[model samples]
Target: MKSSLRLLSALGLSLCITTLSAKELTVYTYSSFTSSWGPGPQLKTLFEAQCDCTLNYVSSDDGVSLLNRLRLEGASTRADVVLGLDDALMEQTRALGLVQPHQLELSNWPLNPDLAWTDTDFIPFDYGYFAFIYDAHKIETPVDSLEALLNSDASIIYQDPRTSTPGQGLMLWMQKVYGDDVQQAWQRLARNTVTVTKGWSEAYGMFLQGEADYVLSYTTSPAYHVVAEESDQYQAALFTEGHVAQIELAAVTAPSQNVELAQAFLSFLLSEDAQTVIPTTNWMLPVRTDIELPEVFLQTQPQRIGFSPEETEAGRETWLRTWRNAVSR
Candidate 1:
């Protein structure tokens, strides 16, 4: 009888462990998205409560870092879902064949009409327009256009194009505005550039410290200050040339063991519950058009202009080369 009892106990323990392991869902995303302040905690709770599964978030430093991590891990990645890559990386990510089709019917889902999203492999959760943010108190008159910002001798801090998405957006912005004279434009802008940081946080932090007149960031960036700090001092300068839009996306890994669960999370990201949590937490506009946004979003709508994913991918290397040579001089 004693031997039988011990055997039963060991079997029960093994069963419990197996059950727990079966229900876990792993997601790889950026550090900020999974931080205490970001949506990861709340989303994890919400997802786990509904699905009876443990949601795990493995984080990298930023969006670019997430992409790099996947490249290193390849088909051996444990991630079921990969989140936080932007449209700028869509073509590249697709080319790598790392992610599988989400299999969600996004048609008539109340997504932003401006997006015109039709990708089968990835889903857009949020988006924001790239703009130069400045303190209203310091700059009584902000540059009205990209041409003005690049032409003026106003000391500016921006991220490195090779390293950061905002920097890439500005590179695309410069190309859109300057066309054939983009190299000359880069040289002119380099003359007054306070310094180029490796990432958005460093450049924006330096700008907040009054190190530069403007910092390249999302138009929705000022909404963070308005909602969180109750100070409306920071604002994104609306350029006459329009702004480039960055749509943050989520995808299921090709090697996912839990394809159904991964697809559920992608669908959840587009759901009303998740959409409501994204804006304030991520500091970007929800992709859903039907959801009500903060007043700040209503007030600061900038016209969107940008290259398609194909165009971005094709031109990126040449553009980076041009940026490097122009800025170095």
Candidate 2:
């Protein structure tokens, strides 16, 4: 009878282990996950607790690189979900159809109607406006407009548009403001251009180190500088031409076996708890209308440049061609 009881106990333990293992969900995202600035850990902890699932994160350096990896993996990829693709790459990802539409019960959550894209192919997590982050001490009189930057003596560092989201955003912002005369605008900017880094951090680092007078970054960049780093050297300039607002999105992979869990994770991202953490950590504006702005953000409300996703898609190729021509000249 004792021998029989031992066998039953071993079986029960094995079943419990199997049940726990089945609840784990794996997520793939950008390398930003490793930073305390990112939402990865918080997301993992919250989701695991709510859904009784273990959260696994796989990270890559950039969104485009992650998308490319997803393509290479086809339907067999281990990633159940992907986060960090922005408006710039949304069309490309949508065209690839690598992600399935997320049908979550988000009726209780108040999402910005304007931020939604195509029946929830992707959900906007956080957003921010793009601007020039410059050293207040280095620049005697900071350039207040795109034209000023074009004509000023201050060295400017920006990421390359083809590779960086902020670079693409600035490119689109220029096109929106300059219209048909955008080629000329690029010509004007090229004259004062110092260098183009591969990503935002590198460009911002150069600005902080005083290598350049300005770096292309978000309007909330000053918030990070003040609250996180406790340095006032960096401040985002208010430009007359308006700032480019970029929204980062999250989506469920088409082949993900854990669709319900992925959808739950998406809903949790927009929760008040998650939204509250974003301003402090990622330097982004919360999509939820109810969340209060942090003190640093209260000083600088990001200016909205008038450019729709449709306009962005229509002009992107032409703008790139013109940008290349202008750079070469």
| Local accuracy of candidate 1 as per-residue lDDT tens digits, 1-329 | 22332332323212222222348889999877897878999988876765678889998766777888898899999999999888988889889988998776676367888889999999999999999999999889899997798778899999887667778888999988887889999999998899998777788889999999999999999999999999999999998878899999999998998876676667667877788898998899998887888899888887878899999999989999999999888
Which residue runs does candidate 2 get wrong by more than 4 Å? Answer: 1-22, 112-118
> What TM-score does model 1 achieve against the real structure?
0.90
Model 1 accuracy (lDDT, Cα): 0.83
Question: lDDT score, residue 217, model 2?
Answer: 91
Model 1 spans with C-alpha error above 4 angstroms: 1-22
Which residue pairs in candidate 2 collide? none
Provide the global lDDT of candidate 2 against the true structure. 0.75
Best by TM-score: 1
**Best candidate, lDDT:** 1
- Error at 36, model 2, angstroms: 3.5
